[model samples]
Target: MKEEMINIQDPILQLKDVSISYSPGKNAVKNIYADIAKNKITAIMGPSGCGKSTLLRAINRMHELYPDIKIMGEILLDGKNILKMNPMEVRRMAGMVFQRPNPFPTMSIFDNVIAGYKLNGISLSKSEKEEIVERCLTNVGLWNEVKDSLYKKGTFLSGGQQQRLCIARALALKPDVLLMDEPTSALDPIATNRIEELLLDLKQEFTIVIVTHNMSQAARISDYSMFMYLGELVEYDTTQTMFTNPKDKRTNEYLSGQFG
Candidate 1:
């Protein structure tokens, strides 16, 4: 394991009594409230469809892409309601990485990384853009592999490389928060380990919230953990306590693999 690099002092984003539904009648994430430790990783774990990803998607306002989804309650990012902000604006502040690696297949690697700045209507000079891409790639632990062939098609890269490229794309925007949904579930153990290392390095500069089914991965990398069950937050606690001595019996049972 790597030595600590994150400054986990205060809460960066806090969800205040939040409830989200796919439609007016169907609940996906319900009364789920949590405080994300600043400059640290907070992993959300639960059974499938238990609102783990739903809660994370809500944080970045991705659910709004679906017309039927309606989010209620306050999501305070630095103490502001994220739902009230513009959808694009919210996403910019909190970048997302989905389950599958989703680099633009047709775009060149360099162009794929610069996609955020180009699409966001933000302008940067050639030198500045190059520097941004290089720095972000380095941050995501991919610079050494792609620094020379950056102009080649992004899809030419391996699956792990593609995932890290997507991470670099997110980092290029220099977002304050990074939300990941099953980021390593698709990769081999070796690739997954690399991503976990990259994430450990990343939290020194960004807040990270991950939805993961791998309890061992969550225990290995996260500073804090939140347990969800049936669309509700059952408990939130430090990783050490959550794994070693959870106060809630439900958390204990779930972590022990009795029932998830």
Candidate 2:
């Protein structure tokens, strides 16, 4: 299928002929080329096992956790190829939030927000740590609610609060891009709405790339939309255009509930 293209003047992330394979001769993500605009929310939508999560994980080098996974082509972040950069640095620059809220069970809310810094062995003065914790928590709209309970374990918060805390942790690193893999799929409707609102607010400062199964959520929150099928990017356009006038048969079918 011919993919629709859009011009981005100064994209923060560029995927050039990117492909991933879990095993030899079996590509899971096939030759995707996209230039993701900065400070915008781009939603990747598709059915199960269509490589949306695989592509999102590659942005932060999460696939490295499995040595068998192989990735090819250049994933550029801020004009530098992230595939060539150190995984630690790449991850720090492209922070991720998973499908579910996963705060460290043993750590306090404050500690969870700064977990990335500690895990990376980056030291900061007590004052600096306090500042970062407060700033990040405030950013995710958790500070006022959790300030009195900062020392409580992060897992103690409600599911939505925990997810927000996870988002705060990602923000603590001040990443250039925020990669979310179905961030709201595990939350209640109320919680999901909060996250959607937070994401909109967040795009003002950080670029967002999200993989979502919920087309409504994608339409509601994303500025741009990408539809993938069978490991291939089938269409990409502004959210307004793609949802109302999708170019590909697959995209239209998926949007119309004819198929996933």
Candidate 3:
């Protein structure tokens, strides 16, 4: 089934003249202004070195973790500037998944799902933790596969299963937006397809912004698409329009067989 089209005005996250630099005098992301809609999937696609991952990190303030990195302009979540919010709070509001699945190797599958709350010093009863685990794992389609093995180490799962578990971990926090960087790139085709299906289902509850180099994957899952080149957002439109009738020549060239 086709996802409902989100009105452009309904933004959950907004970037206003946002720019990021790893060092003085060199910007990795430049003057980006885009609005991501609620309960929709947005794909950020560009060639290598195009600042896709850099911009994704900025949304949740991951850029602040590194020394010598600087960010300018506003990133708003529900009309509030995230730059002014506590980093931990920003991260809790917007969860992230990396290219590689990195569940805590020593932790059990069940423990990994509720690790966020534990690490953040948020207390919950055993029943509450169990409820969170089951709810999140079920949402990510991992509960059925790993229910009996909840006490086993997380690293024992396959790459796809581990990735799904990581997603469950993120979902346990009840985040409003999910930021994924090349989420399915490390998985096999079957696993990638499963993750894609999971993402489609997830958008009904969470706004998702995923960075993917795979054009076919972006076309398959994203409701809206953003094309970036040389640190600039070249075009943004509904996926249907961006793929079929992009307004920018650069977007057309990138969508075509020309330069990425």
Candidate 4:
């Protein structure tokens, strides 16, 4: 079925006829076309192996890490086609946070936040690094908690704090969009609530595309929502509309707890 469309006056990102395949003639994500509005929280929800993560990873060309995977599409970020851009540059513009908190085990809290600049071979002076570290940590609401322990290893922090630190690391690059894959899944309820609140604040500054399995989370935080099933986009609409009056039978079923 064709995905529902909503007119976005000036979308920050556009996915045009996107498809991904792990093997020949077998696509994990079928052609998907959508316009992502600026500074809004958009959620992608679907059952396992439905290509939510595959589609998200393709936004920043993460699929390039595997030799056999193939992606065909035009992913435009701020009017530039990211598919043809340098992978490193694409990643910097659209920073990603994974399902679990993955702070570099070897790096300290301060160093982890600026890891992107170091990895990109971009040099920063002592003061510049300090400024970025503080700003990013403050953005993720982790500054005061770990301020005194800036030199401590990131892995020493709690799961939720580590995830926030990971977010701070991603934000340090000053990305245009933030891509999250089940970011709060590994944390406790309190921690999850904190991350949700953080995301709400973040949408004011950055466009967010999150792949989540939790429908409640989507309803609570997303401005727009996409429901994908079996590699195809089943529906896309405002969270309120989609929840109360979905256009597709599959979407209604999924939302009704009839199926995952």
TM-score of each: 0.95, 0.98, 0.96, 0.98
Best by lDDT: 2
For candidate 1, lDDT tens digit of each residue in 8-94?
A: 456789787788888777888877656688898999999898999989999999887789888888898988889899989889999
Model 2, position 120: C-alpha lDDT score: 90
Q: Arrange candidates, best lDDT first.
A: 2, 4, 3, 1
Better of 1 and 4 by lDDT: 4
Q: Give the TM-score of candidate 4.
A: 0.98
Per-residue alpha-carbon lDDT of model 2 for 61-108, expressed as tens digits?
A: 999999999999989999999999999999999999999899999999
Model 3, runs deviating above 4 Å: 1-7
Better of 1 and 4 by TM-score: 4
